[model samples]
Target: MLVFGPVRVIHCVAMITRVDTYLHSVPLSGAVAEQVGPFTLFRSTITWPYYARPVPGSEATITADDIELVRARCAELEIPLSFEWVVETCPSLGAAAAAAGLSVVEHPLLVLERDDFRPATADARLEILPTEDDVIRQARAAVNLAFGEGGTAVGTAGPAERDANAPAVADGLVATLRDRMLQGVSVAAGAFIDDGIVASGNHQPVDSTTEIVGVGTLPSMRRRGLGAAVTSTLVEHAFDHGVDLVLLSAESPAVAAVYERIGFHQIGHAGAAE
Candidate 1:
């Protein structure tokens, strides 16, 4: 068993700042980060565009007009206008986005300190996959199918669905993942059985902090603890590689509870509007 030290309020606030800064840096790496009013609009140089986020430490209240300006820029670029932010830190942006006719959703944001991780148990074997591994495509397909089904509950989807979709995984996406892994910016992990990858996830590291994203288990594989095990593998990998803080935003409280069982705790909420 692992024991977690009490986090001071001051320390927590400072960690939140680091998380915000790290989040801002990710989009800037692959997109053209432009300042539109009080928000930073991340215009994609590729097929998919990114969202606008409030500039860190900016006190200017986000207005409908500010949202419109970003909307206009997104329109010119032929991309959907969207926004994401830490709700506690950027409290006003959600309402402004909602008032601008975007649907807003709040997700539970959780964090795990190095000392807080507890290894989770599952029947499937968990491993950190190399960029060149052929199973990478299968893992991505499993993730896509898992997220498409959309929930923590077990359903009909399984290995058959995963295999059928594996070949359709975009070559560009696989290439991007490989390039990012080679650059030491991202790491991918999976929980596997003989059939193939049952659960998959990735972590993007920036300095001493990393955020786990896109973790999902095939619907038929749910309730077997694969999601938690995969998350633990990623978190352990991050800590072993010098990351001190691991963060992830869960789709809901129920989803957050899976991470909580492995020692993550809610620190805040992440807001998204589209």
Candidate 2:
């Protein structure tokens, strides 16, 4: 069964609409968005691929046939067939995707309005990194390690593990991140100690809206509030830079609670299928 957040009622419908529109627009900068049936297929023009999303405000019922059409298009393009949507807004798509034999996961979706921003504390120094900074690779490496291990609980991977993986971090990814930063579409930040970055994340701004993503703390460094601190820095940076809304999808409810501590509230659930 696919579970979602508590924003499925009528009162939160407008927010859900706004979020759907924002998400549909975000990938346009780097992907060619094609309207296939009731879905918008974002075909990547860059190294990282994008996913299909339901057309905002479309009330068309999502049948397995619609999913199949999108899947065929993805296959023709040699890209994986995947979908992401705000479950509250596109309530029917999740079941359709699942019926089409895709594995789906529901993420706790959250957002922070400018007025709700709350700063968090961290023992290490935190700062936004410049595009040309060499530390960006290490930061990216740390994030990969964090996600690879997955979850909010503490584990063994940390600075040493990140260092071991940094050299293997693809230059193309680093280049892409730098290019996005240079274009004013993204900003990267990290929590640092003498050993190096222990947690890293970035926010991608599209006009007055931004999504804080890729936030991860080194596994061994978990439970120290570094992830929250990095997220706080990103949120503050986004607000200071004219972003009015900040959004993110956590890996689980426990992880979502971490964001809740710093003032984000659950708005919906982000569903993904592949």
Candidate 3:
């Protein structure tokens, strides 16, 4: 059930962040856990892999040496290092991270309260659907209308666009997204009225926390409440599944405002430590 740990929404951050340069999930076996500074890292594959704290720790402050050790380990593994955390700031630590030439991945970390969440307006006939092979194809067509041809072109892909910079389609990724959907962690809806998949996103489930991810609405469909409806529909389903904490990262206050109307609160802004 642990697809991707510490998943912040891949909204506009997807445009700037490649921290997922690795894949999702760890191997069934325990990932190698090590200590660097005060932070702990759990890793499976060495090169460009996903990692997180092996376990929560009580200590908070870390020394410069601690950061250097963590970096040295990442270098040993030949993998790109990323920050998996939540704190006020990391000025010194960020500088250390940068001196190592670690690729910067900044984001506006977001969270939504389960109890306070609600959709803005119920104008659209929203539907909660599963991920499918054809879903990407449908998403492409719908996004063309919603986000416009420029930014939404990422949807034009259907399996062939996985790692490429072209549109957002990829064959293997589509299959993966489908599996995540069936796992009850992903969803995409076709807008017959809108004429395509006007909305699509995935839920990265960690323990009981579910982060609404990959949430995107077509530009043509903007201001019609489709974004809020699609997101609300997904949150309702997550609640039904017994998830209590729903979080996502948003880049724009406009987008954040939609989630705000639905029962989510602005917990804080999460960006680079520096």
Candidate 4:
């Protein structure tokens, strides 16, 4: 069920290089692009609401014409323009992106691998399950509740109320999740207890690496090791499917600590805006 690859741990710098190469490989669908000065511009359905950026260090200058070209392409697609810049490489792109009227969303993003991954202890007693059938429904509810998608508090009634008032929206979101799971666009795992899902996470695979995303534990369920279980389980799944490396971004130092406990090491920071 898996391909064989000699397992060798990768360093932070090499990992960043691989990430840049990965971006250029992303298939651009039904979109045209051109090189404006040192930067590259491409439009694609998969990268909706944003134009694509070349790998960091590959470009150095951004001209007014470059921004206008991006604007023109975005306008043609009837979507807004956006750019992603990794500070380690593209120091000038941030100012350029800002000048283009793109509101920058900057944060410290940590990268980790399985070598640094700390496994959850067995005594946690949480049943981590693959997202399938009804598990998808429960996992969807768990993610929304844990992430406070419908309200400021994790356990608030907003998610439930929204489900009740807008059944279609909720159902649509869950259905899309299901499709993504089935299509391998994402692999989801959920930790379930007596009540329902308490923790959930996803792995987004691109080429040789899989990105751990949406690793959230319900507020009430935190401090019990459920988050570690969800993350470890997803990492295992990605490896089983032949992914050589796994990466994720922590929202802050505190959150990064939680991931570090599970063997993920901080590599670098990334910037993006939409």
lDDT of 4 by residue, 1-274 (tens): 5443444334455667776655444333224655645655665544223355744566556655666776776677676677665655566666667777777766555555556556775234344455455666666556655666422223543334423433333565566666666767778877766545667788877766777878776666566777778888888778778887777766667677777777777556666755
Q: Rate the local accuracy (lDDT) of all candidates.
A: 0.88, 0.89, 0.52, 0.63
The residue-by-residue lDDT of candidate 3 on 1-274, one tens digit each, is 4243344434324422222211112221225666665655667532225543312333344444655676678789776556554333332444445565554444455556565776544455567664556656556444434334333223343222212322445565556556656765455543334334555554555545666765666554455666677777777777777777677766467667767778765544444321
Error (Å) of candidate 3 at residue 267 is: 1.8
TM-score, predicted candidate 4 vs. hidden true structure: 0.75
Query: What does the lDDT come to for candidate 1?
Result: 0.88
Task: List ranges where model 4 is wrong by over 4 Å.
Answer: 1-11, 23-51, 55-57, 63-65, 121-133, 149-169
Instruction: For each of the candidates, give the backbone clash count.
Output: 0, 0, 18, 5
Per-prediction TM-score: 0.94, 0.95, 0.64, 0.75
Candidate 2, pairs of clashing residues: none
RMSD of 1: 3.1
Ranking by lDDT: 2, 1, 4, 3
Give the Å shift of residue 237 in candidate 4: 1.3
Give the alpha carbon lDDT tens digit for every residue of 1-274 in model 2.
Answer: 5555666455367676777788999898789989999999999987798999988878778999999999999889899899999998888998999999999999999988877778998999999988863688899989999999899989999889998999897888788888888998789999998859999999988888889899999999999999999999999999999988899999999999999999999878999999
Error of 4 at 113 (Å): 3.3
Q: Would you list the clashing residue pairs of candidate 1?
A: none
List per-candidate RMSD values in Å.
Answer: 3.1, 3.0, 9.4, 6.6
List model 1 lDDT by residue over 31-146, tens digit each: 89889889998987653568999998776788889999999988897888899998878898888988999999999989999778888979988999888746788988999999
Question: What C-alpha lDDT does candidate 2 achieve relative to the native structure?
Answer: 0.89
